[model samples]
Target: MTKKTLAFVVYPGISLLEFVGSRTLLGIILAQEGSPLKLGVDYELVVVGERIEEIPTDTPLSILPQKTFADVARPDALVVIGGGADTLLALEDTNLISYVRGAGECASWVAATSTGSLLLAAAGLLEGRLATTHWAYADRLQAYNVRYQATETSNTVTDGKFTTTAGASGAVDMALHLGAQLTNQATAQFGQLMIEYDPHPPFGRLDWTSFDQQRAILTPLMNRRPDRQDTVQDIAFLLYPGLTVFDLVGPLQVFSALHRIAPEFRLIVVAEQAGPVMTDIGVRMVPNCTFADLPHPDVFFVPGGTTPTLQAMSNPAIRQYIRSAAQHAQWIISVCTGALLLAAVGLLEGREVTTHWSFPRYLKDLGARYVQKRWTVNGNIVSAAGVSAGVDMALYLVSRLRNEETAHTVQWLIQYDPQPPFGGIDYQHLKLLPRCMRGIFTFVAPLYTTKARRLTRQERGRPPYDV
Candidate 1:
């Protein structure tokens, strides 16, 4: 079969989730089996920028552009992504606007999400077209001479060849809609299942019961079904009460994209019970499997939280599970304070590791070198600092599991390039804060650690430290 190309137009400060969500959905369709088409064979993915250089996102990481507008003049589909104020400034680039116009004219599918519609409108592609953008930018859409969608739901409006969605969150909806339009509803459903795109957002209100019913029907169609080839590597994500959602999701999302490229990853969310595990942010993530049900995993990932994580560190069952899982696992990974769990289980002794910046001294107390890096690797153990750094660690693991090129492709698929809005606050800036503000944290930090130690001892049926 002849190959078709899909080009994602990116610029500095583009929303990573918007580009990642869309690319993942479409890539899953290409990864499906029933379809005679295959990614890199029947379909190609190209990340096009003004030039072949690194483009930063709203996060700290940056993506390497695969193609330049000078190279990919036209592709089967061209999606213009969007971001913060930088996206608006990117629209002023005459060459970028010209490229969008040229690509829209020739590409089979022309689409944009969030502020990307602004670029589409600037390119004159959304003229007289029904469209949408970020909810905050809905009023701004009218300034560009396009009909704005006022709804705040996850919906995509497609008028002829021009497709648009509300914001970064709606990109998946737009991608699935496009997938169904390109292939069929069944194929789109297959793609949706591949990425587990069922909407159960933390901050947003969603009918989880209805979503659960839908997943019951869709889970069988997902490539990660239990009955699939036993050789597939099982990557288990540990879920405990009150764990931080982003710490778990950051790496899990990276692995999800890798699954699209190679269906060898079996992602299982395992908890003590197969039910909703409340996160620190009040989001309840339902585990896919129970500790009793999950076999030994190839990769064991642990995410950390506050009181709950501290409490879990002393849970004999959880500690035993981690110890046993780490025994057979080729890679043992942790994010944020999740390293504390490893330390408590006697796994991090004499190893270089990192954790959330606020508590690095604890690692030294636990007999590990506190490396102040995004992520640290020592033999089979991988540790990432803070919340979002898990993305870097996971991508690095993907490189180890497959190859650097495959990891780069996965990174491009997710638009892994990052550029923080306010940027990082250095030690000097932090010291410039009010003395009372510094005193508050300093006074509270040890108290939290002391309370956690007390809770850990109580959970372990041991005497309190001071008592």
Candidate 2:
């Protein structure tokens, strides 16, 4: 069997969510066990950029492309990731446009998400084709002789071989549809379950009645370019293999918006090394700095996952770095089971914290009392409930760090207003799953707890890790 390559084109300032959301879904189909498909066997996923360098995203963290455009001129499929103003800027990049046009011409099918459709239109590929982009940028498609499909009617639009998606979140829907086309329905459904793509937006969908007014509010905010300040506070996010992409990206998107308007706030992703780290969903993310490079950031953030997170708890280097950084950090934050890592490090002992709903017992085993809430703040330590909750908690952090008005602007900028299709999670009916998970954690908890205890003893008499 020949392996088909799926190339995702990435550039500086591209929307991280739009890029990762789709890649994660599709990547999982290849990586997930028992799926019949295997990464590098049945399919290969690669992030393609102009050069194999660190390209910054709309968020603080940057992505490292696995291949250059020159390397993969003809892939099985091509996906162009979109962004805000920078996406508009990308339209003027002739080299990029040429690369996109040339590669897209030879690909089996070409796709774009959000404002990325404009890039396709710019390359003269979408002319006379029906397509969709971010609702905010949909009107611009008419200028290229492309018929626009309303996002209200459909999140993804397919006109012949060209596929386009509505917003950043729309990428997920697009990926699922494409995944099914590439494989089978069952394989795509399995991929969806692997990532837990079940979304429950707290608010319920956007109220389109006020679309014009909402658009008016966001246009100027997107255009504003504040001057960088001399003294900037560093907000560091931890990156590791197998960490949930949304857990890191959700809050990172919130803080990234805050950084745009409030230049004094800087966002950075730190890891054991400065290179590409594979996420749990099979997408690779690049960190800007090493742990030793930025040891004492103002704010230190940890994102959580499943088995890898438990494995991370026992890693001496990761544990020591968190322990050392927390000593001088003004704020320490965690999303999902990230709280478990902090608990393992002895930071959450007797502290009121919250984690993903499935791991309260694990949190308790590590010596922290779990409070069931979207987020909990005890002094400078803040822990959010689960994946999507990070966005809510980060907004609260923005309000605290800057001001209510600033946070409100950031919310509007990201269009954070949630309208889940099926409404919010009903914790009342979610008993059996957590009960089953507890039995599994029962066996897994002691292995890490004992190791954590041993690491703490070894570090007590010594100074912090050199990094």
Candidate 3:
């Protein structure tokens, strides 16, 4: 097999996380067993900068280049790291830009992260395509007249051969997309799977029953399942439980917010069980599930979490009960892991969907596509990842149910503004950043509040960036 070369080009004031984030993705993809891009086989990570001596890393540690931009062979993929506000011009050195111009002609993919796109734009890499960066530098980056729209979606933009990310976290999505392009879906899946895509709530999580796929596995609890019809105007979650604090609050609240602005389409938030739900931050909420017991509503909503109670709902009988209720419900919607329960009941087979990235394993184990995207709408079904993401997805859903005018208003209300105060790009790895900007805007932000993984002996000392 022809070996693939990945050249990570670094410069002064580079955002360290974006730089390391790119390499980490390529590293993770190669680390998986039997993956097409195996360690020591398909790819090699090369950090290239201008200096002949050791370079300063974005973090406190120092970084050494595998090769200099003035010397390395042309690569299959060329990645430019994000730089600081002032470094955009500092990185405008002719030697590096010359190499990039040549790579632009030879490399299969040209990727940039954060303000790194500014480098490419400076080198004339993004002449005609839409590009983005951290919203702050975005003003400066766009000063060059590049079309810069404020988009809060996931990364990996492909314009012919150029790819760019919005900001720091987007680097992961960009690299994964590049991985998919270099390899294949299954190869990409292999790497994603090795990252433990199967999600079990720290509390535990699940997927589906069996065929008679669409057949009911049990009796409906009330008048709702009396049996079918309606193409599905919209699906609203009408429950107090099974919602992640964010999803439970964000999606429903945002959807309601949209209605408050414009009332073209109808919305319903129902519940099978009634009570108060404590959100992720301890916020309390009382739901409107009375319809779940009345005439079967056209749309169905399953909230996230419900982790503590998912086991009870996992039964075939309960699955059948939900299946029967859904028989009349036009669309089934779940935000985050709530989609898994829908899948477990056989409602999401072969359907395009999404749940939070954190719930990858749950999405994968159920054979659901836990895409890094916010929302994936398949006919009759729509699912969203995380609670915050649910707002994005729901707004999209609201647009489809209502209109673009309404969606635009909702987007503005939420301030869908994403200029991170401390961009995470600087915290990724030592090798990726220039020493100049260390500690200014650190990525890999402090850590998740809770311990993400419980590593076994086999995993001891192994890198945990995958978590």
**Residue-pair clashes per candidate:** 9, 4, 29
> Ten consecutive residues with minimal summed lDDT in candidate 1?
199-208
Q: What is the alpha-carbon lDDT for the whole of candidate 3?
A: 0.53
The lDDT per prediction is 0.69, 0.79, 0.53
Tens digits of lDDT, candidate 2, 1-467: 56788889988889887787788778866655555455335767888999988888887677778889999988888999988778888888998999989988888899998888999999999999999877667778779999998766457889989999876557777888788777666677655544444553334345668778878877776867768799989999999888987789988888888877888988888999877898875557788888989989899889898889988988877987898889889999999889988988888989999987667778777778998788899999999887767877888888889887777667667655443222345555544544576577767777777887677666676766657
- The per-residue C-alpha lDDT of model 1 at residue 26 equals 75
lDDT of 1 by residue, 1-467 (tens): 67888899988877766776677577766656556444234667777888766676654334557778988987888888877456777878999999999998998888887789998898888877899876446666788889887533445778898888754446766777777766677677655533334332212232334543544543333222223455699899888888765677677767866776677687777888865666553324467777877647899899886667767767866876786787789999998889988877667879999887555656655567888677889989999876656777788889899987667555544434332211232433333223344355445555444543454444354322220
**lDDT of model 1 at residue 163?**
86
Q: Is candidate 1 or candidate 2 better by lDDT?
A: 2
State candidate 2's TM-score. 0.83
Q: What's model 1's lDDT at 194?
A: 33
Best of the two (1, 2) by TM-score: 2
TM-scores of the models, in the order given: 0.51, 0.83, 0.42
- Where is model 2 poorest over a 10-residue stretch in terms of lDDT? 415-424
How many pairs of residues collide in model 2?
4
